[model samples]
Target: MGVSPQQHERESFRADLDGNVRAHALRCAPIAEALSGATRASRIYGIRRFFGYFREAAGAGWVLLGDAGHFKDPAGGRGIGDAFHQAERLADAVGDAIGSDVRLDHAVAEFGRWRYRTYAEYYGLAADLGVAGPIAGIVPRVVRGLHARGRIDGVLNLLSHRASVLDVLTPARVLGATGGHLLRAPGRRHATLGELGRLATTEIRRRNAMRKPVFQSGPAPRPVQQETPEPELSR
Candidate 1:
């Protein structure tokens, strides 16, 4: 929900708070519903949260990788991907540090450049409408034009943990291909689960009622019984 104390102060914290408990948090900068068990559903039904990095960076005086350097909305779920990629890049620098030609300063510079660029793209994408349901008090919903802005693929590879920042561009291309399908679907612009539930509950309830008859049509076929016998002991 990205429902932070800061956001709560600014906008009266209107984000939905309907998630179920998965576990308790130990004061870390940090929900459940019926699951779809599909990739898209998995992305949606889970609660989203993100940590901001600027505060920690200002307080600490060392080079930071990841959201410590920058962060994006957990709505997109790209922060982990972004951090993982940054770590991979850092590992290369570590290797360089171990070699005769190590330049710790150069590695730090490269990391800052890469981190800022990644944050630039990430922040720009997140700022657009339709990315995080609705930004606090900007509007009732995301504008139709920006509804399908979609997740950047380099970003998703970062999310899935399958690729590093060096490999994000390829996935970015694929995300561009079908990312707008839902937005383009008739009346899907600005749609969210709350909007969908309003329209579908009646029909879904009816369907569930219809399913009951089939379920009640006598007992389902019984499983064939099987038993395991004890092994014979040696004489």
Candidate 2:
């Protein structure tokens, strides 16, 4: 994605409500009584959000959580948890810096360096999934890979009511040293929200312009907005 205005807005919206929509869609679906005992369904145009959490070290080794540093798509219900987790990690370092006289600046600088890996992991997952909706192509490979091992096991791992979107997107083997091969074999290894969103939108618009309804079925599914994503049966 070349980063257009509308795409920017869609990404912004996904940070909260829109992200939730994507999260919910990943959930399993149920058969509707009205659908002749069938279960396949599609969810479109719902609010979703993707979240990002971070803190910056202030002067004198003081740290302040940037107000806009946290983001989430209400679609997944994971933002607040992510923010708190970051805060917890930072709190210890902050406390250590304040309570001890052991060269505070050096300790604070070390904290950032040591925490770099964790921060990258958190940010990477959110960045990929946050834009997942707009970049449908990115998901197919990951989702299909999950299918081989039954139920897309790693897609969503919520434990104690905490969501882990990071584990859902990139499996370890695919993301590490082997990732270079993936880049070489592809049409495009990475995708952007703006590009994918515009592609989806343009296709839909073209279909409408041609007066062609994409649905091949006899009728549409009953529109009931659910809190969770459409079930696997629908996919």
Candidate 1 per-residue C-alpha lDDT over 19-70 given as tens digits, one digit per residue, 9 for 90 to 100: 2111111133322233223122222132223233321211112367665555
On TM-score, the leading prediction is 2
TM-score for all models, in order of appearance = 0.36, 0.39
Clashing pairs in 1: 20-32, 81-158, 153-172, 154-168
Model 2, span 1-235: residue lDDT tens = 0111244465454455333344344343432223334333454343333223344433354443322333333334455665576577666766756756555666666555544434333444444444533544445555665677785555555321233444454436234313543565555444433444554464455435334212212222322233354333323
- By TM-score, how accurate is candidate 2? 0.39
lDDT of 1 at 30: 25
The lDDT values for all models are 0.40, 0.43
- Misplaced by over 4 Å in model 1 are 1-61, 99-102, 129-235
In Å, residue 198's CA in model 1 sits off its true spot by 30
lDDT accuracy of residue 107 in candidate 1: 63
